[model samples]
Target: MGATMVEKILSSHALDRQLRAGDVVVASVDFAMVHDGRAGNALKMIEKMNAKALPFAHRAAFVVDHFSPPPNAEAANTHAAMRSFAAAHGARLYDVGSGICHQVLPEGGHFTCGDIVVGTDTHSTTYGAFNALGTGVEGTDLSAVLATGKAWFRVPETIRVELSGRLAPGVWAKDITLHMLRRLGAEGANYRALEYVGSAVEAMAIDDRMTLANHAAELGAKAAILEADAKTEAWLQAHGAAAPRPVRADADAHYAEVIGIDAGSLAPQVARPHHIDQAVSVAEAGTQRIDLALIGTCTNGRLDDLRQAAAVLRGKRIAPGVRMIVTPASRAIYLQALREGLIETLAQAGASVEPAGCGTCVGITGKLIAGDGEVIVSSANRNFKGRLGNPRAQIWIASSATVAASALTGVLTDPRGVAGGDWRVQ
Candidate 1:
């Protein structure tokens, strides 16, 4: 019985030398993160615990992202408290407009391969894109990590998802994850690890892999990881990160189940309102009207995502009666987009470009205040009822290209049908 990638990472972090699936261990966390949404509460709990110091303060990060710029007085106070706490504790603090924690952490080179990282955000699994074992934890659990730099886990069984073929035109990583959700449902990988494998996954860029790993939480996965390879090394080198020590699963590694997907067979996919698992092909979803089109979030707010949206929006105007919003995931990405004229392209298309943050995704600001039954086509993840603040406001999740194409037509239009540059499939 060879060790899986997850098993190897866990064993390295675990106090027990022979950690395995179903075994309990207190693993050391290399890095921990807390976002504004949960920072105040986590701080309070840490105070209650009377922790004098955090063992990993240098590696810990506090981000003021959700509800950035302070939507209201209450949120402002929370952000202030978080800022004060971070400063006093010597933990790295990313102020409002810095970016979402998930994006900022990796973009800042805080994450490295083979590290066991945990955060207060479910999307913390985004770090898995670097081949690190990242998982989300509750506030209490995070407080424990803050106090002692350790947390417990029951090693999860691994599910090998082998992707084959190449993505077709206008389709992207977002569609791939949505297709998986449609096949596996919401709880498909509950309490399990999803190990992405195969040629298609290997061909995916680091940003694309982040998109897949970020959605693992929606599938109820404990963690979603990819084997570190040359692409990973290239990304790390470009970021000036240390030379990578890649982690690989043994050839005979045991998997609870193996699933294969042909990426070439996939089309643009959309998740209907109220549940992420209720996904259907864009054509099958029909031409539904939309009031807003959002083109950014931690899931799809990287530079490449913005470029894709820009390609569709350049030299075009957004549809009448539709408000389009584009938010970069980080300050770095925002600046890069500006340098490339992506920001101007979106603005010229009648889209409102907001600061880098999780605008509207958590419903703190930029929310839809439309009539009942209004629809929004968003690139952000999660389309649950009232996720964007109004229970009556419906959300349709799709790729940035799809969102931009639909923004031009005020309906669910596929990018392939629109006037856009050739699709750049990875």
Candidate 2:
């Protein structure tokens, strides 16, 4: 079959194929995961169906993230529910503070190339990082995965984004992606797999590539993939997955649309919602005071991001009322930051550093209380309504530096003013 990454992955795991739009297939799902935020809902659905989460390798993962270290005994109760269910079901579990689910999956070798996966969270599209045909589903749909180890999908078309050039300082991969989405609108890539290529994409880190794939869903793309390279190989090695069998489309690859983004000339970009496509350049995303600023999540929540925030707050303090919640992506990152004094420096700067978890991003934790507050700078993906504390809150998505600078200044401040050399990921 003439193929793309999506097609190739589906064929490898083909339970069935739907060449036309009206066709539907219930493919065997490889991995089905749920985090604290949605685990309870998924479990309830499974219980209703009188079934276990799943019984297969890489199936039935319970991730304890969303509310880490337990906001209170009530939150602890929620964690208990996940633990009990996972144990009873014989599933692998990553407790809170272990790292966001996305960070932990590859580490545990739960994700692999040519795999078909699904999860409850929207950002689940992120698994495409390893060339897996992955996407998000509603908790009900996810609960079915837990029950039957399968879900349905209508094959999506493809969108090809050919990225070129090395990124300039302060112009990271996230910025380049937001620019494209803003131009295309939130549903720009809806029901399509986005394949990113070019020199800029070739040079990106595995984490950076993951970030691009992470947010492609924001533009309504079903999934994203890159031609696997040395980085993918190295990353897969660490994950204990075999050397990544790189996948790519043929020269005559089919795409519903073709777009080009030159990372070299791009600057920092931000997505202010109501929509992810409502993007603005870092320098042009006019300054606006924020009630709360958060750094971390499955999306930019890694050591590199923490280091950038630390660099911006090396000698600064967060403005009062502008609560800055900094969460490390994983326990390892938290410990490394602790040893490196990044955590200490962040706390000293009036930032509320929490255990590695999701907060203020997914709206389930670290809620803000400002009445009628708008525009919270965060590093998480998808700024949907009621996503972080308030349905009315405006979330301005940007790089870690912008989030930190905004926390320090109480206003959206560009990170361009901050020196980069002084930053260290360690």
Candidate 3:
């Protein structure tokens, strides 16, 4: 049988040059990343292991995000330690305000096709948008990679997700991911690799692909990758990255399973509180009153996402008694939004634009929804109970456009209702 993309990449990096599903191999890592949340723990492990130096310091990055600006003295000390560790080990350290690690890594041209990149964050799979093998690891695993420049992996069976047709108006990659979550429960793809294929996926922009790949982990996927093509090359080129080496599965590649989806059949999807798989259509979800609306995160904080939100909030203002927050994923995206006046537009609409970082996505910092039974519509990935820092508060996950539209009326308003014309303030 012809080799799948995952098999090809694994075999190429494996010592034996032969790999199959469930086969364990020690492969060299192309890049490794850690954010402030896990950096202190990883550093402690390295010290405990008595590591003299990292074998691939140049390829490792330490990002001070997720609580950017230090919410407290303890966080400040942790950031200081991470910075010291990065400087001493010669690893690149992106200080506070640099943006989320996943966004910064790719925006800075550290990821490319066919590379094996790992991060201490579960959303590390975001890198797979570029056709790279990205996986999240624990602190112990990260420490081993840092000490030896290699890590072991059991080659995951590949599940081919074939996409056909384009998304309908008002729907987005976030909705698609949420739809998949609803179909395939939380553990559906456990220890498996989700390989997105077909015309619809190929037609999607890199940012959209990132949204799909970022949430694969929520389905228990070990990794999710898209086949690199011309669009991938164009995005890399536009970002000043070197020419990428595209990788594709062989024509006769074997897959564990094949699932087909018609993107045109999908509509706006929302994930209710306490579980990402608790998804329902906007109509089924009804008009949920919201006290806060958030419009950014690693999943949907790129320029395109911000622009879409800005387009909706242009002439309208957020509803009374509702607070809205917008955060860019990276410094570069923030600058671009500023140049395009997206910041002013959001502020004029009563949305507070915070610095580029994780913000309230990780429940680290931001004006979180207070009081029991409070509701928030956020574009971030997860909406589990207490995910936004209050167990009493509920979160509903949707696309940036949906969040923006909902912010206008302080309820779960569908973006389609506001698209194609000026939004009337109630």
Candidate 4:
């Protein structure tokens, strides 16, 4: 049988061997990253390994996010260490406000199509949107790659997710992801690779594609990849990456399972508190009251996402009692939004714009804590208990449009009501 997309990537990166699902291989890493949360630990690991020098330092990156501006002295020290380490080793450092690791790496043109990329953050799967095989690794694993430029992996079996039809107005990639989470459960695709294909996926913009791949981790995916076509080439080139050498799976490639989704049938989906899989249509979620509305994260903090929210909030202010926070994923996205007046629109709507970083999504910075008996609707990924730094406050996950509409009304509101005109980013 022919190899799947992930298998093809692994075999290409491996040494003189044809890798298949279930086969273990030591592959060269094209790019590796460690964020502020894990950089200190990874540095300690490298020291523990007694490495005199970092041979592949140029291929690694250390990002200061999660605690971007240094919430406390401890976080400040961690940032200091990361800066020192990156400078000494000749590695790249994305300082505070640079953005989330996932967003910065791609924007910096660190990796390209068919490359094997790994990061210390779970959402490393986000890079798969570029047709690269990206996955998350522990700090120890990151240290090894930093030292040796190689990491081992077991080729995961592939799951074919075929998409058809287009999403309805105000129904975004986030809604589709939430629908998948509901269908697949939390770990339905555990240790497997998800290969997204078909007309609907091809029609998606790079931002939407990133959103889908980023959330594949919530399905317990080991890696997530999509077809590399003209869109992929243009995005990589625009970001300063080298010319693409895209790869595709054989038509008859073996897959563990094949699941299909009709995007036209999907609606604005909301994942109830403490569980991403507890998803339901916005209408079915009822008019749940919300005290906080967060509109940014690696998952939905791109320029398009901000524009979508701005479209809903233009000439309108958020509810009287609701507090809203809008964070851009990176400085580049932030600047672009500024040029487009998205920042001004959102701010005028009573949404506070924080520095570009993980911000309230990771709960390390930003005064996003929810008080007792309060409810939150966020555009970030993951809504587990205490995910927003408070176990007492409930969190709900939805699309940026949904979050913006809900913030306008102080409850869970379907975005289709007000997000139809001039919402899509051209």
Per-model TM-score versus the true fold: 0.97, 0.89, 0.96, 0.98
Single out the weakest 10-residue window by summed lDDT for candidate 1.
Answer: 362-371
Best by lDDT: 4
Q: List the residue pairs that clash in candidate 1.
A: none
Off by over 4 Å in 3: 240-242, 364-367, 420-426
In angstroms, give how far residue 33 of model 1 lies from its true place: 0.5
Candidate 2 on 1-426: residue-level lDDT in tens? 367777666655554552432245667788877888787677777667765435552376788888786777777887998888777778888997798887777777776777777877777878887777778876778767766777777777888888888776555667877888878888888788888889987777777777888878778878887777777777788768744656677776566888887778887788877677788886786767788788888888877788788888887778887877888888877898899999998999988877776755666675554346566788887787777668777888888877887787788877776654134322
Q: In model 4, which runs have C-alpha deviations exceeding 4 angstroms? A: 366-368, 419-422
Local distance difference test, candidate 2: 0.76
Model 3 C-alpha lDDT per residue in residues 28-86, reported as the tens digit of each score: 88889989988879888877888776777778899988878788887788899988888
Which candidate should be chosen as best, given TM-score against the real structure? 4
Residues 193-258, model 4: lDDT tens digits = 999988888888899999999989889999889999898899999999977879899988999999
In angstroms, the error of model 3 at 234 is 2.2
* lDDT of predicted model 1: 0.87
Compared with the true structure, all predictions reach lDDT values of: 0.87, 0.76, 0.85, 0.89
On the 0 to 100 scale, the lDDT of residue 197 in model 4 is 89
